[model samples]
Target: MTVQLNNGFLKQQTGNTIQIDQPVKLLVVNLMPNKLETERQFVRLFSHLSLDVAVTFLRMASHHSKHIPEAKLQQTYATLTDVYDQQFDGMVVTGAPVEDIAYDAVDYWPEFNTLLNWRHDHVRQSILECWAAQAGIYVDFGINKRVIPKKLFGVYRCEIDQKTALTAGFNQLSMPQSRHATLGHINDPRLAVLASDPEAGPVILASKQTHSTYISGHPEYETNTLFNEFNRDREKGLPIQLPKNYFSKDKPTNTWQRDSIHLYDNWVHSLKKVKV
Candidate 1:
């Protein structure tokens, strides 16, 4: 998706005179090979928020990216080695298309594990999405990811577990998810379900004690995200399930893509307010 940002949103302040609160520097660990798009997506999500957010992109140095342009990576992303022991107010680990492989089988698993452990100790809060969420469960609590019989693709409705701080302002909000892996068969004692579907219950959200948040869905997806993915996979002859309830008339061309800025904003705000 081509993203364009409005310069009007940025306010000019003289730093030589005085500076206010420090901008919340977030280290976005993008497992998605397309570093350009991932960076733009994150910037788009957090740009509208009132908080000051500065993002630094981190990519796995061990795995060679095939989807993203090599030039883009050299220009925009940094390897995991570039950021170690650096304190970040927030951290994000994005999902990738590597769910088909075993966690340890992935080339960067060792470095990835190290990054996750560091986040647990340093970052105030962390967000894990889709496959990353599943991997996190495995790394943190020895939980495993199970392949479902079918791909759970679509705009699913999640009923909020109102008691949690993450759901403080959101109740019965609809989120977007496009993935083939699930955690239904995983046995993990530390995992907690913050919201669930009536049909697919136990979509884990947050743990009891950790500041990490796991979202099985891609709440940050653009309106055309699913549609684009569907077409791409179809062209590639990859087996992909249709996104259920994504189109207004259940037609691919009629899908109305929308932003999840509100949800993203709420999450960032919640992280700031959450006391560890």
Candidate 2:
């Protein structure tokens, strides 16, 4: 069956959408403030996949999101308890703008921990992004994120390590980074750096034992995402700098689009070989 997508580029993808016996079920923990926009961004990539896939957006029940109305969240998003008995082909815990604060201090941290623990047994493959990456690593591997003096904001070229199923096609790719912290030297023998940059540190990390992937940057970001963020901070009279390698003339080029799509596509295709 053909699935209708959210909006914008996603709407045009209906014709090209893949048909299969069963869609790969994916659970995404929506930690970003703009839920709808994040949906559009991710669904856009999922639409390009060679197999059918279904995405379920999950939200934290403990914390009240001030940006989007609670009424809307309840109508669409699932809570941790809602999917406790369900099994998924893959899971993704997204990044949030809570890098400066300790993980336990966050209002939803307790429940977030519960969800993370659940992911291992119930989900086939899992990915943690940005702040979530730090949290997951600390919990699973005891790797703590260190705060940098300045926010590492902008597009950066990351060198891809020896190819794995998840990063097979690319040697090196440019991904956007927007964070206040970075993963320090990884001493754990199980954890492998799939991609890294001198300035951005470890951008993509993976561990076979955990069956999880961690991405430190925003590869799924829309071309204008960093641009919009920079303008917003500047307008609020906050300390902000122009993103490095992001602008040509006046607009930002989408340097990471192909790589981001490639990464997600690989993850979806690998689902068949994974057992929940």
Candidate 3:
């Protein structure tokens, strides 16, 4: 259950050995256009933890990806039908680029609904990120996301509920947020607000029944994610503002998000404790 690492090559952690068990099977439903980059981001965060997690990427069978090559998708990803009878300890639904559109308008909305319903029986714990968070809330609780005046594209300071297992070690957390829509008001009794920000509203929401976690911000985002998004928008002549608290001296540099890593570590621990 434990393994040692020396200081020579593995520079991320110092000390001797780390404890690990049988690798946790995680199903990742990637909705992002840039599938490979998103997968790498999640894998990078998951690798930092002591637990070994085997991730299986799931692509939408209903929606065809225009950005990623068809051959690559066929080779690397699995459809819902491929793993319909299988179950996982944890499932992650990534944020998509379809935030501007209505939930019913998206091509994969129906398929998404099917997947959400399936998770009730197939998954032990699920984490929905950004647009998928909105979708999950709307599908399960009938809470619709509202359009914001400006895109919430920046690194925000969030107040975490330290008492929650998902955020046990985090007091205040900084995460990357990039979305055009916001979960305006959630009045569901089954949902608990785990974290929030004045600018970003509800950063984290947890469901009492399904043990599902929803995150409006991208904790798995790399340091330059927001900076790259800002530049991309600017190049396209889109009205974009500088990501707050991201670049020091207004210059893009690698921002070490140690707290984000801890947040994920806590989440993986919580998943491991689940009785399934």
Model 1 lDDT per residue over 1-276, tens place: 111221111111111222334566677777876555666567667767766666666778777777766665655567666667577777889898888898888898998888887786778888898889989878877777778777778877778764565665656667777777777643455666777776444554777566788888776676677888888999999888778878766564322123255556666677667534
Where does the lowest 10-residue lDDT sum fall in candidate 2? 1-10
Model 1 residue-pair collision total: 2
Candidate 3's error at 8, in angstroms? 30
- The TM-scores, one per candidate, come to 0.83, 0.92, 0.90
CA RMSD (A), model 2: 3.4
* Residue 52 shift from truth in candidate 1, angstroms: 2.0
Question: Least lDDT summed over 10 consecutive residues: which range in candidate 3?
Answer: 2-11
Which has the better lDDT: candidate 1, or candidate 3? 3
Sort every candidate by lDDT, greatest first. 2, 3, 1
Number of backbone collisions per candidate: 2, 0, 1
Better of 2 and 3 by TM-score: 2
Q: Give residue 149's error in model 3 in angstroms.
A: 1.1
Report RMSD for candidate 3: 5.6
Residues 1-276 of candidate 3: C-alpha lDDT, one tens digit per residue: 222221111223243345335667788898988876786687678778767776677889888878867766776678899999998888999999998888889999999999999999999899999999988998888888999989887888888753688878777888889989998766778998888898899999998797799999898898788888988999999999988777777676445368777877787788788845
Q: Between which residue pairs do clashes occur in model 3?
A: 1-20
